[model samples]
Target: MPGTQLTVTLSGGDVADARAVVRALEGSFGAPDELPGDENATVRTATFSAAAEGASGRPAPAPSGGGQEGGRLSAPVTVTVQGTPEAVARAG
Candidate 1:
């Protein structure tokens, strides 16, 4: 059976947000090919990783009102999607 793989890299402090986007894509498309039943559907797996110093650069400045300083953070997320050619096309 034919399948498709999709990877999306993200940099930020929030993981939920990244997940949300992936979920949205899956919902809009379908489940991954590896998953059962979702064979012809779109399935996604997200891998999160921190970015290097030179990549993200310094963290954002501290907020006003004497709040704790915010550190620079980066997250790289890879979303692998698989599905049939028809499914992949539909998802695309």
Candidate 2:
């Protein structure tokens, strides 16, 4: 079956830091099938497949209830998370 995919686009901050933020999400999702874009780009994107097999050959865990907590980034960043309606709800 096709998986639920999440495309995260990040702008502002350096590409490396933006990539770091996306990689951090792997703890809850999994390794992205499509990694962040060019290192020199001001904006980059990463895509994660929720139902796809990970390195362990198992689907990544479904994200569940969580509340946002105040935090600070090294620099200002604009982030956009896009996915199916169901997937976006699950991510929340």
Candidate 3:
């Protein structure tokens, strides 16, 4: 079966803020095809790929905010997550 793809977009904050969220998700989704850029764009996006749920050995565990922190967000952000139903559920 084809793998699932998740695309997350963060707005209303700088790249650092976006990176934080992305990094947090990386714990579950693995690496992203697109990483947030340093440029001062209004939006930042990251795309991650994963095998369909139950199609692989096991899913990655969700990330925790307490241990080994990912990063801090300087401000609030508007996140837009897009993908197939399975992909969205996995990312959620």
Best TM-score among the predictions, by candidate number: 3
Better by TM-score, candidate 3 or 1: 3
Q: Highest lDDT among the candidates is held by which one?
A: 3
Candidate lDDT scores, in order, read 0.35, 0.66, 0.72
Residue pairs with backbone atoms closer than 3 Å in model 3 (clashes): none
- In the range 1-92, model 3's lDDT, one tens digit per residue, is 25578899889877767877887777667657767986778988888776522356354564455323435567789999998787688667
Worst 10 residues of 2 by lDDT: 63-72
TM-score of each candidate? 0.32, 0.65, 0.73
Look at candidate 1 and tell me the lDDT of residue 73: 27
Question: Model 3 Cα displacement at 13 (Å)?
Answer: 1.4
- For model 2 the local lDDT of residue 59 reads 49
Better by TM-score, candidate 3 or 2: 3
Location of the lowest summed lDDT over 10 successive residues in candidate 1: 47-56
Model 3 residue 28 CA deviation in Å:
1.4
Candidate 3 Cα errors over 4 Å, as ranges: 51-71
Q: For candidate 2, lDDT tens digit of each residue in 1-92?
A: 25577788899887656766665676656667766668689888888786554566444653342312333356888888899775565445
- Best-to-worst order by lDDT is 3, 2, 1
Candidate 3 positional error at 84, Å = 1.3
